[model samples]
Target chain A: MRFTIQRDQLMNSVQDVMKAISSRTTIPILTGMKVEATEYGVKLTGSDSDVTIESFIPVEEDGIVLVENIEPGSIVLQAKYFPDIVKKLPQQTVEIEVDDHFNVNIRSGSAEFHLNGQDAEEYPHLPQIQTNQSFEVPIDLLKDLIRQTVFAVSTSETRPILTGVNMKVESDDLYFIATDSHRLASRKIPMGGNVQPLSFENVVIPGKSLTELNKILDDSQETIEISVTENQILFRTKHLYFLSRLLDGNYPETSRLIPDEVKTTVYIDTKELLQSIDRASLLAKENRNSVVKLTTKENNRVEITSNSPEVGNVVEEVTAESLEGEDLKISFSAKYMMDALKVVDCEKVNIQFTGAMRPFLIRPNENDQILQLILPVRTY
Target chain B: MRFTIQRDQLMNSVQDVMKAISSRTTIPILTGMKVEATEYGVKLTGSDSDVTIESFIPVEEDGIVLVENIEPGSIVLQAKYFPDIVKKLPQQTVEIEVDDHFNVNIRSGSAEFHLNGQDAEEYPHLPQIQTNQSFEVPIDLLKDLIRQTVFAVSTSETRPILTGVNMKVESDDLYFIATDSHRLASRKIPMGGNVQPLSFENVVIPGKSLTELNKILDDSQETIEISVTENQILFRTKHLYFLSRLLDGNYPETSRLIPDEVKTTVYIDTKELLQSIDRASLLAKENRNSVVKLTTKENNRVEITSNSPEVGNVVEEVTAESLEGEDLKISFSAKYMMDALKVVDCEKVNIQFTGAMRPFLIRPNENDQILQLILPVRTY
Candidate 1:
């Protein structure tokens, strides 16, 4: 492969692909990043069995040349060193050439690097999702969907299926839901009439893949196409492609986990409640779950408290905008609550409690699309 | 103890003293920070036995009131939680009160924290360095001296004395030197007859102490007083006191390690040489010591190269301003060279080599106050 590319454009593509490359891959060749120069542009690919990322730079875009002197060929360079070398190259543009023996030469300014590269033919091929069913979602909204639900996925391997986010399309609405048994997060976005007539159920994408994809996707209004097959899902943008393997087995039905009845409901400023819980958590950190208790009082007043016998106790009172139903005291993981509150993206939140021992729900007061449920700890 | 102090001022003092407190200290009380309130201000102290730092906040500085409602008393609070509490408090000012039993209450805005506190009497007293001789140095210059020499200190404890920077005052010049056997760095400052007539020949301050002290001291032209005794050294500024137990041993003589005669010399741009070495080190990282070879060529050209048989090789050519004497090739640790060059605050640097086997010297081309020496590795 022979090509001269802009340093920054290549660096960005390398970083995006690097997110999918793992040094612990059992397949040694998979640890390398494949670089291909075509007549149109340069393409970089990285994979580690579970996830694969590909980024392409065009020869010219908007009349500005990003890559030049392209020769159609391919080589796989060690991902371990290629990224750093490209990042620290001495000029705005770098020239890369590969020999018949797969020897890679990278030159920029007066610095030149000769690296032993693996034959691109030895690398595994990317899975081709040959399906006509695909949907489109704006990049920013897609990133938000991932962020809102991915953190709730199970980090433990006891239940491997719970490690993925359940993505479903029904009734012209797309829903992303994730639950670790202890807490759950769900976000729904109206598909409107823009999405094609396609529906998928029980499509559980590994949460790690969604997290990495969220990091690589810029917050732009540009829409990205999503395609799914029997075992893989692909998120494709104009110059980038992210593919992740779906977890095996069925995802558990989580709709029943969210509480239906509310014995107490309080509307409070999101920032105020988040801050109060954070302070209470400071003293509660000694506990395994970092549990903190919230109690509703008279006159729309609520008190958050946490006690650690070895440390001390903290109490903070926050006034709610309104309160209804019975007064309640409940304890739950402070971290879960903080994470949910952070992604609420609204000024006020409504929290509903069924009882002290059951799961409760927190939702943005202005909308019904985002909901967070947390299983209360039996601290009494 | 009772006081209401400006949150920012109190936070800075807490952070400063926190540097000396370690959670793994053998003495349980040493993990707590001592807080003393007097009519003047509040004093915070933390110690890990070997090093102690005390920071004070006065009732008023300049025309602003920093502390108010002060009652004279003292208590010790867990360093683990106190700093974080002060950081996230909900108001501009924080009210702290301690009961006779050492129960502490902190209140800010509507947030209240009750923390268990230890009796201040159990905390060890600050060491008394009673000395009639003391000298003064500018805070910024002192910080620079520590930065320039501390990185060369031996991280290995095999030679305990080499883990400390050797400090000496002679002939109206203060010098700081450190070495890890393989490399040595020395910096000198002319006292200009303004310092007191006190000289110390064998004072060695622990490298860790200087590093922490450097972090705490702001870059300012204000002078700080330094006092040394048989076992301890004290650095006292207007509101901060840093006391460190001196390392107990004789520092190895390092003056002879620097070559007195030069076989070859090269003058190069400091930044250019540093960047070139950094690039070469990228490929050399697989080697234990990250060795890179440099060879001088005709027309003031120098080549840097590194190779890892299992990986690949890199070659970079950098042009020197001038070269003289014999043609030479030497290999040395790229990390050590980079560290030394970073401290040379000049555009051009003069490097002198004494044959291929002897230690070479690097100094700013314009000054003789700072010098760096590195022992080359034997590579045929």
Candidate 2:
């Protein structure tokens, strides 16, 4: 492969693909990034058998020449050093060429690097999904959807299926749901009339894949096309393609886990409650579960408190905008509540409590599309 | 003890003293910060036996009231949680009161914290250095002196004496020197004639202590008083007192390590040489010492190169402003060269090389206050 390309553009593409490459991969060739130069542009691919990322740079874009002197060829270079080398190249323009002996030469300004490259033929072929059905979602909205539900996924591998986020399309609304048996987060959005009326169930993408995808996808109004096959899913933009293998198994039904009856309801400023919980967690963190208690008081006031026997205790009172039904006191993981509150993205939040020992719900006061449920700890 | 203090000011004091407190200390009382409130001000002290730092917040300073409603008493609070608690307090003003049962109560706005406190009488008394002889140096200059030499100290405790920076006064000039036996760094500054003429020969301060002090001391033109006793050195400012114990051993003489004769001389842009060495080290880092070779070529051009047999090789040519004497090729640790070059504080640096095997000198092209020496590694 021989090509002269813009250094910044190449660096960005290398970084994007690097997210998919893991040094711990059992397959040796999968640890390397495949670089290909063709008449159209240069493409870089990285994969660890679980997720594969490919980024392409065109020779010319918007009447500006981004690449020149392209020769059609392919080689795989060590993913360990290629990204750092490209990032620290001296000049704005970089030239990369491969010799017959599989020696890769990278030159920029007065600096030159010669790296041992492996034949690209050794790289495993990327899974190609031959599917006609695809859905489009705006990049920013997709990122938001991932952020809102991904954190609630089970980090423990005891239940492997729970480690992925379940994506389902029912009626005209698409739902993303994640639960770790302790907390549940779900977000829903209309698929819009432009998208084809398609339905998919049991399509679970690993939470880690969505997290990495969220990091690489820039927030833009442009729509990205997503296609799903039996075992793999692909997210594609104009010059980028991200593929992640679907987890094999059935995701548990989480709809029943969310409580329907509310014995107490409270409306409070989201920021105020978040800060209070954070302060309480400072002491609570010394304990195993980092549990903090919130008790509704008279005159629309709520008190948050946590105590660590060996360290100390803290209590903070926050005034609620309004309160109804039976007064309640409940204890739950402060981290879970903080995580749920941070993604609310609104000033006021409505919290519904079934009882002191049951799961509760927190959601935006005005929006019903996003719902967060946390199982309360039995402190009594 | 009871006092209402400004949260920001109190937080800063807590953070400064916390650096001296460590949980690994054998003395349990040392893990807590001693808080003493006198009629004049509130003082916070933390110590790890080797080093002690005390920060005072006066009731009034510069016509501003920093503390009010003070009652004379003292208590020791856990350093681990006190700092974080004060940092996240709800209000700008925090009121702290200690009861007879040694329970500490902290209140701010609607937040209240009850912490377990110990009697301050158990805290060790700070060393009383009764020395009449004291010297003063501008805080910024002291910080610079520490930065230039401390990095060269030996991190391995095999030779405990080499882990400290040696401070000496000779011929009306004060010098700071440190070396790990492979490389040496020395910085000198003149003691103004207005100050008393005094000298100390073996005052070696621990590198860790100096690093912590440097972080606590802000850059300012104001001079800070320094007093050295038989085993302790005290650095005092208007509201801060930093005390560090001297290392208990004879520091080996390092003057002979720097070559006095120069067989080759090269002057190069400091930034350019630093960057070239950094890039070459990328591949060299795979090896143990991260060694890179520098070879002088014709026309005042120098080549920096490194090769990892299994990975790759990189070569960068840097243009030097001038070259004189014999042509030379020398191999040295890129990390040491980078560390030495970063502190030069000059646009161009003059390097003096005796030969391929001997040590070399790097210093500012025109100034003489600072000098750095690095021993070359044998590659061939």
TM-score of each: 0.99, 0.99
For each candidate, what's the DockQ?
A: 0.93, 0.84
Model 1: CAPRI class? high
lDDT of 1 by residue, B67-182 (tens): 99998999999999999999999999899999998999999999999999999999987778888679889999999899999999999989999999999876778899999999
Specify the poorest-scoring 10-residue window by lDDT in model 1 chain B.
Answer: B193-202
Give the per-residue lDDT of model 2 (tens digit) for A162-280.
99999987667789999999999999998766445544555899999999999999999999999888889999999999999999999888888888798999999999999989888
For model 1 the local lDDT of residue B165 reads 97
What is the fnat of model 2 with respect to the true interface contacts?
0.81
Runs of candidate 1 with Cα error greater than 4 angstroms are: none
Which runs of model 2 end up more than 4 angstroms from their true locations? A194-196, B194-196
RMSD of 1: 1.0
Evaluated against the true structure, the overall lDDT of model 2 is 0.92
Interface residue Cα RMSD of candidate 1 after superposition: 0.6
Clashing pairs in 1: none
Model 1 vs. true fold: TM: 0.99
